[model samples]
Target: MNLRQLIDASEGVVKADRVITGGTLVNVCTGEVYPADVAITGDRIAATGDVTAYIGEHTEIVDATGKHLVPGLIDGHLHLECSKLSPTMFADAVVRYGTTSVISGLDQILVVAGVDGVREALREAEQSPMKIFWGAPFKTPYTLPETTVGFNFGPAEHEETQDWADCYGVWETVAEFVLNRDPDVLRALELAHRNRLPVFGCAPMASSTTINALSAAGIRLDHESYTAEEALEKLRAGMYLLIRESSVAHFLNENVKTVTKFGAQSRRVGFCTDDMHVADILREGHLDKLVRMAIQAGVKPIEAIQMATVNCAEMYRIDHLVGSITPGRYADVLIIDSPESFQVERVFSRGVLAAENGRTVTAPAAPERSAALSPAFQVPELAASAIGIAAAGDSAEVLVVEMDRTVPFVRTRLDLTLPVKGGVVRADVAQDALYCTVSERYGKTGATATAMINGFGLRSGAIASSAAPDDNNIVCVGANREDMALAVNHLAAAGGGQIVVENGEIKEFLPLPVAGIVADIVPEEMAAAEDRLEAAARALGCELPSAFGYLIFLEITAIPDYAVTDLGVISYHTQSVVDTVLTSR
Candidate 1:
């Protein structure tokens, strides 16, 4: 690992352990592509030039003669926990697709088990082939009040910055800034700043005034812009832009257009998949998909690779070890047959043959520690009659959350008159409205709020998920209250997971033992289970785009206008629970 030895190897003074001769090396650092020989010693690239003398006895030569050698891909931000698989299984799914590293928003761990849970997950992430970096989550219940399911952690749970940045090799606190000049957020920013950590951003639909304030608060990069104009404005405001393409949002193509419009201003623009599901990754791809999307948007292949590799490493200040194929850098290389298509044929992570022929050659690392049970996963007992909604009289009026198909994140509150029977409100199938409920999962309050939601078009049946974002409460949408209770009860009894029930029978189920959020299964199995659940929802006459993903967001309060929580339905503007009944109507 000495510089003198590497220099000697470059001059044929020493033998290299491995020599990859005659490959078109992609020099992302200089934006150059040329034919060269790369010499590797151990896990570091010893030299990258004509290395005719470096070949000797015991030198392993990788025949890359006509193939393209590029740095392994890097994802700017992700949530492996949400992939519904353990860290080991998640790696097997993405490494074959050529992803070498990622920055994970560990907020999922915080939400399920607080900071202690985060520490445990970080320990397990070390066994993964894909280098996982940590990001300090700013949206815990302490920061965002609606994140409460009565699971509160004091400042003691906040692991010191050194524990994350040094021991766990974390990058920084991601996607946060003061909301309405909140003092707690300001205090959190000061803490991060004191530790010399860079803060990433998440500011969607922010006006000039808010953007300026965010910039001044040191949130330097954003991946939330949905349009080219919005991305350009963020860059103009001295913030880096991450063109995102996730399971729910696809902004890579539009942001590439923004990069083209910038001409020279494209340096600050990059790529990321802030949130993606395992089914989508198994079907489409990982970071590789975003790269292909960029190429389709008229972006040069090398430029897109830069955004996926170097740009992200530079943003996190980890370029010294990764993001390039140069001396002193980890030999994380991808062998592709062509530059035009960027088809990754073979992969190497840290000089290990991690994947070959679209499959991982390296087996998953052994489980370092047993899975710690998160108390948040505990659920209270409930009956089929517990979720019932009592009505004042016949033909009562109520406000329903209307779901919009074809386009996501749009809904209109409709005043609906429903017939009452047995002193309870009933669902109206003719109007495509169903009863949706969010029940407390931590067992603090056996509270359940039932209301009508339009959009699922469920003819008859119920679907329940404990994968609710932020709080991980049980959210169920169904055409019948009895079936809704059955689905929710099933999910609770299984610890925590997703379930689809129809005609008093269970159709699809996937158990998630990790805080009732992540499953102890491989990506293939997880994807298959999710696919079956989607098909089951469709079979039950529920017509909505990807019912699995669409309904999970029902309890997400981070999104727009209206969202349901265990406490009640929340209005983002008022930051309080909105009434379910239309008294005036």
Candidate 2:
């Protein structure tokens, strides 16, 4: 049936603006692969049949010779901010990979910092070819008991959120901080529904009471599951589980026996690359890698695909648009060479050749830099004097916290007695350890906490980074006190960048002029620079936490706890924010 004849026959019933000729359709709805011609009128698919029978002049035709058509791919959950690329660039990069849609969870960190920045991201998102569905960020961000560092929760202005609520009606109810079962947070969830945003909760609350409230309040998705038990409990409680790549990787590596038990229940779960850097994305692939890993770890391919596709679509209530290659769904499909290998031969997004043989066909233009997104770098009063040691005699015994490799928390504390040099406790590099300090970078106060951590491998140097998005005063820490001082100065010298100091001099640096936190450079360049930072840290004898820089955001009260921010070290276990430097040492 030619599309025109079909449209003409259904003229009083259904109409199509365009038609595609001779395409193999993978009907996800029926699990059938058959020959059919597809007709599109505007963005929606109008009809599918043997279109040659009803050809007509008004229809725009695309010859899908020997091509297979499927629905566009959806990224269930992601944080576009960590990509370092603005939303436009991000859309451009992923569209080629067949990602037509993304559920931007917790993305408001980039938007909530400022109204102007939020507007810019939204403007770019609106203009982009790929669909960008945003989740409204709840839970006041970067708000500690005493500090309002980085981007404080700018007032929830209606401009960025109103469209999603009033128009599309998708919203997110995020719970910040250690899940202390705050009823107010539940109230915020109710408010999200009131405002018309479908609520999605951030996982790992300390109390099940909060989880129950969120579930009862109708917040139905979670992405942070540190253990399998937590993942299962949430699923039973009716919250959609968006399992993160790293967390899954960690759990699978531990030889945990329960993954197989949960693998059968994978339908309730979806995949996400929550916080994947661009370099890693280029080298390792995106959610595809997570899918591949799951398959390799004994998950059935059908189940794995469901986690990446149908499950995701159902969770976000976008099943009608994509997730399956049903007759009516948009033709967004990947032509994989082999079902077993999952080697993508070509990709079609929105019925167009977005990627072929392994690269993007169209790239999105970079977003214009907003002055509000960039922070003003403040030269903190950090000198050699600021890096201090507490001791009564010529020798000092210090407690150095040992960080675990697989997790985001410290494992044990190391007690070491070392000689005091020039009235300061000196780091013993021969022992492959050193002193570290976390400074309050918000310019609220000159408060700094000096502590010790092992496994940086540096004998006489320091490395420092920060997540303070506003004042640009980096919360830096180092092994060598003098080198620590030099590192911050080096960062300031470069107008706000990450730096490694060795023996009182700058050893390695990546100039992050954007917000004094994210890189202004391209993803590959930033990845190379990050690699250099890791190499430099390892060369300095650090081996504890390889992704150490990520630690800066953990301490903020709004995110899950056991983290160090510019405010102070917080023990979510005790529900108390503690000093970086302990007096007992």
Candidate 3:
């Protein structure tokens, strides 16, 4: 921990505490690979490439004769709540895959628990080996008139983050607000610029004019570019691009082409798992999976590794503390089989062995549960009558939100006619259309809106979740009113979580007690619980790969086409509420 000792150790005047010998060093800083040795003193890398003079009898030697030493991967942008695991458990899951650090937005937690909740989650992350940095989420409710939230994050909250040590920058500056030059958003941007913090961007499918406005407003990085051309435009416009590969979204293959076709030197790009599931992390790996996918897409192995390491660190201006194996860094390194296979054999965090051979060796203790994070669902008791759609006549033509079978988040508005029984319209299962609802649960408003959706593929059952992104409101979809009421009430009674109900019985449930978004459990248990929920959905004739995963996107207003919120169905194209029922006859 002493600066003088580190300098002396680097100069060979003091013996290193640990020395890794006989390994090929993958220098990300210089993009070169060669045989070298790494010497570590305390939690800092003392020297690299032949530490013969620094090694002493007391030094612990690690054998890596055929392995390559590379910098531990860093995820530039992520939403930890999307994993459904607590911060400590999420770290435990990804650390084995060589992801030693991550930068996340507190938007999910901020909506439910406010600023205090954000601080509480950050404190919990400190106990883990994975270094977690946060960006101050300036937009909470996302948009007015479409959704509701517990807290409204603005310029005042941005100013408060200036004093928080781990606060990195403004998170996900929305493109629409910048293009419109919204006064509050501009004030927040000004505050971030005055503090010298980089503004993270979210401008998917943006036009040249919008990109220009965003750049002129000081937004520096973006992760929503879906195509190679989009990525090139953002890079040419002087914005750092984060190639993303999430559980539901797969944009890595298309975006990595920017590096493969246009060369890697001029483009500032990195990797991010914007919103990944724990099951995906356990089965396919984390950022390491992204690195491999990039290689498969024709990107050079070293360039792909650079995107996962130094590029992310430099984007956040944390290169001095991490992102490389050089001296003066945090000694976070990975021992991989080779660049082609990209197999991680060992992981070192802060000069200590944290994981080996796809397992954690030094799992940190779980942080104590915070009382403030306890779920506080305040919605009124619901009945089947409360969720039914009343019809003006025997039959009615309604506007339905159709989920794209391939991409669940991509929706389309469809007009269809349905029969009415007892003056109430019911879900037409034969047509593959089901009723969907979003209920406000933050105690501010007890509002709930119902709409019809297609492509869920459920023949008989209902699914609901309180972990819906952006607004964090309760979203449910079902074929019948009874099962829908059962699922919604079950989540309310259990504080908050996800549930699948069939025939008025709870088939499967996973409790997310932490602000109704994350569960305080280990990765294995969380994955198992999610697996059971998916299986339950399948048993009821649901068709999606992950029905619960698809259910959570119903309330997300950022996506295109249509989104169902507590207020009503929002038409993204029109930017206003649309009639769910088109005509009655």
Best model number under TM-score: 3
Write model 1 residue lDDT over 431-500, tens digit each, in one string: 8768888888876777888878888888999999988766778999998777888888888888789999
Assess every candidate by TM-score.
0.92, 0.81, 0.96
Candidate 2 Cα lDDT to native: 0.58
Number of the candidate with higher lDDT, 1 or 2 = 1
* lDDT by residue for model 3 (355-462), tens: 999999965566666766775798887788888567888889988899877754778887888877777777888888798988889878898789899888889889
Task: Please write out the lDDT profile of model 2 over residues 45-104, one tens digit for every residue.
Answer: 556666544356676777666666555656776666555455665665566555667787
Model 3 lDDT at residue 372: 68
Per-model C-alpha lDDT, please? Answer: 0.74, 0.58, 0.85
Evaluated at residue 70, the lDDT of candidate 3 is 94
- Give the Cα error of residue 571 in candidate 2, in Å: 1.3
Query: Candidate 2 vs candidate 3: which has greater TM-score?
Result: 3
